[model samples]
Target: MSDGIPLIPVIPQALREAAHRGTLIPFVGAGASRLAGCPTWAQLADGALMACITANKFNHGQMEQIRHLSPRMKLSIARAIESEHALTIDYEKLINPFDGYQNNAVGHRVYRSLGKLSKTFVTTNYDAWLDTEILDPPLSVSTDSPVQDTVATPRVRRRIANVEDFTPANLNQENCVFHIHGSLVDPAGMVMTTRDYIRRYANDRGSDDPTRENRTLTFLEVLFQHKTVLFVGYGLEDLEILEYVIQKARQQFPSERPQARHFMLQGYFAHEYELMRSLTQYYAQCDIELIPFRRDQRDWGQLTEVLEAFAEAMPARAPLELQVQMEMESYLEP
Candidate 1:
């Protein structure tokens, strides 16, 4: 342990090694934002059903079973409502409710831990939780406030959402957050509905395509091929994105999951022995190592400690990892 911080045993050594080697990246999911008061995908989907009921639009055919529909299917209904009624799904207000949200201490702690872990982050979530919590301004920039984190560090710019933004020429400049599904900035771009997911998949050139031109696909493909990604803030139900990637990778590389160096931080209960075993077997099949933390009731309180330990265990790196190392030993001067 560096200094006196204890490394969580569940955090695999290879993940730490990848961190030191500058290959590990955190793939944030909705569960992380839920810590900060954002709605879960199920809750968000429920909003759609509630909205339909409030609008007196519920209970036609499958709409009769709207309450029972899965989140994805519920979102498909939302899309239909938006199309038919010209009603807007205020995702921003739903995501970042204008309550005492800024004072979300636990959420901020998690986001800050993420900042220390890596400069390049990938998240499927569309909220500005990370943008509000993580900052890396230039050292030259001075803040009037006494807060140290708001100044000179790994500056997190606005999330990169466009296909044009993922290029190494663009990403190599500074800290980057890749929001694979679009953020709240562009509702049209965000993948929420079933149709949206289909459209996104259509745009992606599969892993086998050497000549694929889509920047997002290339970025994901390259990261999976080369990096050890530790996926945090995901639940058993919300791992469709991770599963999608593995399936795609198998089309090209069938011997193992394409993301062979992947890991996920998961929560389970004391009584979920059988469930845990099944999940472990499933994740192993997908080539992901589980970093399980036991939780109680509705609180994943230990997740914060686990994240903190991960940040502390992984050695820090020079800025702009794709460039030369900041602490490099001397090579022979040419």
Candidate 2:
């Protein structure tokens, strides 16, 4: 029952403050989805390896050659796979495992909670869980047939334009789910090899597409303006994100001056804590604080209770209050 990973207590108090303020912007990663039964990135890597074996193009030898490649280095896996085609490799193999919710209980609980609490989300994983759940409630949100689908092939992908179509008007529904890496169901989705990360974030192509560029900039603007970011599922393994957050903090707090407002949310993983420290030190000018949580401490149920308490304590913020009410009704509805 014991996984070798060390457990650390994420700062629960700050998380509480964020929830109440409704300024908490959650950036979920693969780990968050794991609670919902989805495979981890490493698991997906193994599956891709197996898919290569099944294709028979790569005997045990070729598979060995590509085995060392990281999950992001999936292009190496593609080369080993029988189908050298990008879409084929992605769709037939890497896509299925992350397609929909892996289990009903985990999916329903998490999505329901997400529906209730979060207004905006950014997930690194390619799963459609959030997209499917948005329209249908307890069911998968990613599966809801989008009003339009322009993806003609697996190689090409599309971005979910904006929340205008889905968000209710009177509600001032500023909340949205942004799939930074794209989704599994959408072939044009952003999932790609290690080179993709280099091309996208590292190389600054994340802004290449006008829409993507605008959105990324907007996200940064909102973040600087708002000053609260809840990091879920991110292990700090991605240095690019570390760099971005640091830079954003610096821009907000230009001199040796303290930041007007800025905070972060991270799971109670020890590595995450270390990463947080390193980041703060690197961006010493910006007084960014971190809120951490250990989901496994009492399961997500307890986590929700804590977040709810956090939300309750926040000073009155009308916009977030309205969003919370709408989500609560939708979640509690029979």
Candidate 3:
């Protein structure tokens, strides 16, 4: 069924090379979790806002106003709820629904495939699905749970909240799962409100502030600068982080040259040539190559098919003889 879906000619080979070279990193988005029964940002925000308004016993006029707002206006609702209730919305509650939901086939396959290729995974999701279901066996190496591996073998199952925690040692160890926007384990760390966004992306506290002053942005810049990022399960609506990174890149690297170390797998239709062209050019400014999976229908199953094909096309692990030869060559170098 998925074979009918089309991809840009060079995407498969390009992705294959990155996987073989261990340079490819998966940047998961909310769509991946949605596949696993988790709600989207709009859904979570709308639900939480409605609950808060009802709990507070607002007047009929105010209640009607809240009820009439579109789901897309969730952020605004969240802010209103915060102001009226004087309570911080716990986004962890939204992620709780995914706690025990069985893994969706597509998400399971995508992550399993990713685990075979790279050691590090990065995402903005608050759910624990990636840590609990996908990157499971390695046991999340940490100070409390140390991993025993030789230099030739690296463990990549650890999860970190902040970008600063992604140290040189962690990067070298591989298999590090970074939740750049906090995880369910830490509700206080989650960035949900408009105030949180301002603090994270707008406020500038100079070089000393970790909350602002471009610390997180710099971390992303450094990460993207060195790794080949493959963006999966993301749509145009989920462009906040991508847009921020692009803005930072432009400010940091003002050169006219284009960079293309990142790729995004998105769905497109046959008749949307103008839209595709415009989006391609728009992302080109950020040096991200957009690979569109041609969709005959509007369903998301095509994404799963594309991912499955991509994973299947990845070259198998190097042969034992080649591994031994490489090890011997490295041993002789010193």
Say which candidate scores most in TM-score: 1
* Top lDDT hit: 1
Candidate 2 similarity to native, TM-score: 0.61
For residue 182, give model 3's deviation from the true position in Å: 1.2
Candidate order by decreasing TM-score: 1, 3, 2
Question: Can you give the lDDT of residue 18 in candidate 3?
Answer: 66
Q: Which structure is stronger by lDDT: 1 or 3?
A: 1
How do the residues 277-307 of candidate 3 rate in per-residue lDDT, one tens digit apiece?
A: 7887888767788887777664556666676
The true-versus-predicted C-alpha distance at residue 30 of model 1, in Å, is 0.9
CA deviation > 4 Å runs, candidate 2: 1-18, 75-87, 90-102, 132-172, 202-218, 244-288, 293-334
RMSD of each: 6.9, 11.3, 9.3
lDDT of 1 by residue, 1-334 (tens): 1122122435688887777766667889988888778888888887766676667766456556666778888888787887788777777777777542456666667777887777577889988766543444335344665534333233345678886676544433336778888888998678888777765655445546755555665566656655677888888787687787556634444564453378888877766656766787788877787766667544576778778777777844534444333212111222
Worst 10 residues of 3 by lDDT: 148-157
Residue 170, candidate 3: how far off, in angstroms?
3.2
Instruction: Give Cα-based local distance difference scores for all models.
Output: 0.68, 0.49, 0.62
Q: Candidate 2 vs. truth: CA RMSD? A: 11.3
